[model samples]
Target: MKNILKTVIGIIIIVGIVAIFGLKNKESQDKKDISPNTSSSPSTLTVINNQIQVKNFEGSDFENITEKSIQVNQGSLVKTSSTGRGILESDNETTTIIDKNSEIRVAQSEQNKTKIELESGNLWSRVKKVFGQGEYYQIETNNAVATVRGTNFGTFFSDKQTIFMVSEGDVLAISINPETKKQIGPESTIGAGQKVIIKDGQDPIIEPLTESDKKLEWYVFNQTKTTPTATPRPSPTVSINPTPTEKPSPSPTSSPEPTPTPPEIISVIPKTINVTQGPVNFFVNGQKLKRVTGLFLNDILIKFFTIDEQTIGGTATSELQTGTYDVSVTLFTGEKLTLPEALVINNE
Candidate 1:
């Protein structure tokens, strides 16, 4: 009997130890799985108004209009609005409007994609097209995806439904059906001057932009200045003089000393270098050079270039006067890296 009791006690002790060790191992694994891996690449934000404030959670730098450019970290908030304008321009020219009282996260940005997650409040975006197809900018709330294109769109997230209004282009609003776990159909194309609302359980409703809903007046602000009218000038009367009476008898001395030959003006011939990346763009003098993929020397990708293993042979050269120049190469991977300056043929 004593032996049996001792054996039972020993078994119970072993089981308890094994159970505790197993539980500890499971807890350790769970902790490892739950911790998220942090990213190093810094995000960027542009403040359009004085009302906005950007906080860099990772200690990465951020820029304002005063600074001109800022490097933002993973978590940041930018404020902006009508009285104060804050515009964030990405490497790809995707502009985000940080409206008043908005909290947004610099979610993720890479060579091919950029995502700005709106935690709360309102935001307006004019996302430029990246290289390939798919959603470029997404505004998500409790249950909606406002897939934005290279257009002007406004998004509002409150305790209620996520509201999207398309001021100048198209946007696809998608929502998930909680019970089915399947994505519902996107609301009909919200064309320019349209608005769409995504509620918790109902389908998206599309409507026209009313006076109260018009947030951005793109055409009004972007219209070109009108040409000024010119006043006609009165013509003045002119008198014709008779030819001077052969006063040059002694003239002709030396046939006017044969006119000195003028120096030759060298005509510069510009060479066009073809640069092919996934897609190519050129900038010169801090301004965007249009249609530069296959063109003349004046078109230089001054600040950016997209290069890959396939772009090894591709080169960009300018027929510029020999002097120190500031040249930068921006890879499509969102890397605005500067290259060592190369000397051109000196004209001097």
Candidate 2:
């Protein structure tokens, strides 16, 4: 009888332990379900003009907000009214403004980078700093990606084309042809007051500032006109004596203004470096890589044949492997900058 009782006690203890563990496991899961994970990084979004509507995947809707900063989510569409302007400040403190009649989708928002996919209309972005390596905010239009590091630029997408204009800083524009699927070389470096247009089924066109299109005068005028109005002053009365009138006729002659000096033109000479290859692999320097990637070396890709007429400098998978390769550096102003000769790659 005692042996049977001992067996029953052991079975009861096991059952109680299993039940306790099951309840604890269910409790932990319930906690997780009740609390969704959210990033603790500090970010803000402000509705600058009209009220903005917010919709979430949990079927939550918020409306009638004049100016409020709240956490935004991916795939959330922030739409503005006719006079509405919304500003989104990312976790990295990047600020972007959505102008009136515009719609922007928060594609990816993270601690490192914040990407906004524009469906239509205009957006002005000012990125303060890049968080880390490989951290960049990508603004995708219908056709291209405007990768920004720390820039102040505006994007306008209409009729399947995107117009990117830099107001203060620079941006790298990358576009892939719709039919050809080949990456289009960005032939232009968009500076402040410069614009680049990317149209579908056509090459990108960059134009300089025209006399009629320049807004520098307007900007200066507006800046100078914002001061407080000056009070009107009464005109000074002049009482002239008969004796002083005689002396005034012999007033001293005023000295002529000094001749204005013309500014000197400084000629810039680009430095050249040479590279030679043996039978090993080598990598370009960081600064050189940045310069090449910035479209300075795009001509090499097009004019690869002048060096090697045969085989087209190797296949797509296997680029030109053997022989000495010379890389020519050039400035944005069409000045030839030289690079040192070094062995790039050797397949043999």
Candidate 3:
């Protein structure tokens, strides 16, 4: 009886040990699944010039970000001085530029999605293509949310309104209900060379981008970084002739001719059409396009053309071949701008 009792107690202790081990393992796994992503590298904020401030979620005092770059996590608030500018590169393949006198919060950041809240300021975001099904990049203000997959865009948020401008690709703009914190009303699509403004109690207003808008100081600064400037070749030196050969009279100094600004066509209405569709009116919108004297699909000219400062349109006849082609515009000065794969022709 004593031997049997000892065996029974030993078995009971073994069973109890196994049960405790299983329970502890399950609890650890549950904590791992529920906790935020702590293993991924944190996003960073880099100062371009001047100074910036960072306020941690647990800290009340704002600390100056003087290093070349500093890691930023969720709940961090970034603010720029009146002349300060900074760049934020997240692990999710998105980069954002914080403009001067602006503030933003890193709401939720992870390897797949990054959400930023623009409290009061201007920001430029460059997002890479997100291939995953649930992956997204978003910028939010109090009244609006701008979501994109892969594109370059700018957002300006103020008390009065929020402006979304797309330099490339597209952005979906949606208004938010203040009290319930849910999306409301119809969504607006803002395309390249276009902007949408969202005001309180009003629908989104879409408009073509203007030259002045493109010339904003921060916009131009970003452009210069992406667009490379050609290096000027050294002027050829002319060796003086031995003994002053007949010195010709100096020709009158004439002013150098001004360089022509290249006109562009960014958006084309009726981007797709079937061959069966007779003639269709197509509108082209862009900057510095007022001087465009001719518009072409492939090599053929559009008929009944009308040109304006920011827009041009004409009838696209059905005689054109059914294939994708470039849309190009020629300025009066002979400079040309071409948008590749802009018009698609289809067969019914």
lDDT tens digits, residues 25-122, model 2?
Answer: 99777444423236424345565444466654343464545333566665566777775556677767677767767777676777776778787888
Candidate number achieving the greatest lDDT relative to the actual structure: 3
lDDT value, residue 143 of candidate 2:
75
The lDDT values for all models are 0.50, 0.54, 0.75
How many clashing pairs per prediction, in order?
13, 14, 0
Model 1: worst 10 consecutive residues (lDDT sum): 262-271
What are the TM-scores, per candidate, against the unseen true structure? 0.46, 0.47, 0.54
Candidate 3: regions farther than 4 A off: 1-41, 224-348
- Best by the TM-score measure: 3
Pairs in steric clash, model 3: none
Q: What is the lDDT of candidate 1?
A: 0.50
Which scores better on TM-score, 2 or 3? Answer: 3
TM-score, structure 3 vs. true: 0.54
Q: How well does candidate 3 score on lDDT at residue 20?
A: 100
Q: Write the per-residue lDDT of candidate 3 for residues 234-272, one digit (tens) a residue.
A: 454445556757655544445455455445566664577
- 1 or 2, greater by TM-score: 2
